[model samples]
Target: MSTPTTAPATDAASAETTAQAHGVELTEVAATKVRTLLEQEGRDDLRLRIAVQPGGCSGLIYQLYFDERELDGDAVRDFTGVEVVVDKMSAPYLDGATIDFADTIEKQGFTIDNPNAGSSCACGDSFS
Candidate 1:
C-alpha cells in the first residue's frame, strides 16, 4: 500500500484533529445520483464519503461510499441536500477535484477528475 503524504500521526487524538482543510467539488449530476441512492436506501442520515486508499495497479485508489458516521478531521459540504465528506488524509489529494456521474449506453457511474493526480493507471482505478 502506498503511504499517505501527510505527516505521521503522533496519537489517535492528534490524528483525529490533524486533518488539513480542503474542498472537493460535487457536480449536480453526482449529487442528484447520491441523493437518489440515499432515498432508495431509505437513509436520510448518510453522507457520501470519498477517500484515496492504497492498492490497485497505481499507488493509490479511490474509495467512495455512503457513511452515517462522521470521523474526526472529516471535511464535509452539502450540495442540493446531499452531503459529501472527505477524510483528513485524503483531503490534499482530492482538493479542487470534481466528481461527476456519466450515464449512457456504454458508461454509467461516478467519475473523479482530480487535478492533483499526475497520471493514472490503464485500468483507470488508481492514480499517483
Candidate 2:
C-alpha cells in the first residue's frame, strides 16, 4: 500500500494570488501594444512598470516605462505575454486602475483609468 502525496499550490491558487497581488488591470489593447513595442526593440527582458511620483500640477504624477529590474515588494501581473509591475509604495494609489492603449487622430498613447484618483489635472496626467 502506498500513501498519496499532497500536491503543491495549483494554477488557480497562483492565479488568485496574482489577481490579488495588484488590483491593476491591463487591457488587451495595452498588452498588444507593449508586446509589439518589445518585439520592435528585439528584447524580451523588460517589463511595463507603472509608478506614482511627486510632481505635476496635482502633486502626483504617473510614470510608466519599460524596466528590466525587479525590486523587492514589487507587485507583478502578467497580461498574456506582457508583464505589468507596480511598486509597493504605488500599489495603494493604483489599486483598481486600468491601463489601456489608444491609437487615434485625437490621441495616441497609453492611458490610465484610476478609480482611486480623486481629482486629476486638466492635462489628465496627474492626480491629487
Candidate 3:
C-alpha cells in the first residue's frame, strides 16, 4: 500500500481569515473574570492565550494562560478591555468556540464550549 499524504499548511493571513469564519468568541462573563484576575495580579500587559495541545486521555487538550509574548500568526480578539489570543494551529480547532465563566455552587471556573470537539473525556478536560 502507498503512504498517505497530508495537506499543506495554510498561510498566516488565510489561516486567520478561516479562524475568524469559524467564530471563536469570548463571552462577557469570561472577559470580566479575566480582567479581574489580571487586576488582582497587578498586571495590565497580559493577554489570555488559549491553545490546543497534544496529550491528555482524549488525544487533545486545551491550554489557557496569560501570556505577554505575541507570537507570529496569533489570532487576537478584544472583548471590551480584555484580550484573548489563539495560536494559528489551534485556531481551526477553536472555531465556533465560546469561553465562559461559571460561579455556581456546583462549578466555579472558566469553561470552554467548543463546537469543533467530536468527543471529550469524562472530566471534560480533553477532546478529540
Candidate 4:
C-alpha cells in the first residue's frame, strides 16, 4: 500500500483565501463544475490551468483546460477537490480576474471577468 500524506481538501473559505493570495478568484459554482468534470474524467492528478496567450482580434486570448503537468513558477489554489493553476507569466495579466460558470438560457459557459483588460474584442474572446 502507498503512504498517505497529502493534506485534506480545502474548504470554501480557504479557497477564497487562496484566491485572494493568488490573485485569481474561482467562484463556488465554477469550482463545483470543475469538480464534476474531474469526477467524470476519473483522474485526480489533473489541475485546471489558466493562461493568457497572444492571439485573437484583441491581441490576447485566455486558455483554460485540465492539465496534469506542473510547470515551473506555477501558482496553484485548491477549492474543495479541484485545483486551479496559473502560470507566473499569466498572473500579471489575470490579476483580480474572476472565473464563473453560467448555465442560463441566454448564455451557458465559463466566463472570465478580468480587471486588467483595457479593452476587449467585439466577440468578447480576446482583450488587449
Model 3 TM-score, 2 decimals = 0.83
Best by lDDT: 2
TM-scores, each model vs. reference: 0.82, 0.85, 0.83, 0.82
Which candidate gets the maximum TM-score versus the true structure? 2
Off by over 4 Å in 3: 1-22
Candidate 1 per-residue lDDT, tens place, 31-118, comes to 9899889889998999899999998888999999999988878987878898889998999999999999999998899999999999
lDDT (10s digit) by residue, model 4, range 19-120: 445688899999999888888989889999989999999999999999999776788877777788998899999989999999999888899999999999
Model 2 misplaced regions, further than 4 Å: 1-20
Q: Tell me how far the alpha carbon of residue 2 in candidate 3 is from the true structure, in angstroms, after superposition.
A: 54
Candidate 2 lDDT, tens digit per residue, 29-127?
999999999999999999999999999999999999999998877889888989899998999999999999999998999999999999999999999
Residue 34 of model 2 has an lDDT of 97
- Candidate 1 matches the true fold with a TM-score of 0.82
The lowest-lDDT stretch of 10 consecutive residues in candidate 1 is 13-22
Global lDDT for candidate 3?
0.88
Model 4 spans > 4 angstroms off: 1-21
Which pairs of residues collide in model 4?
A: none
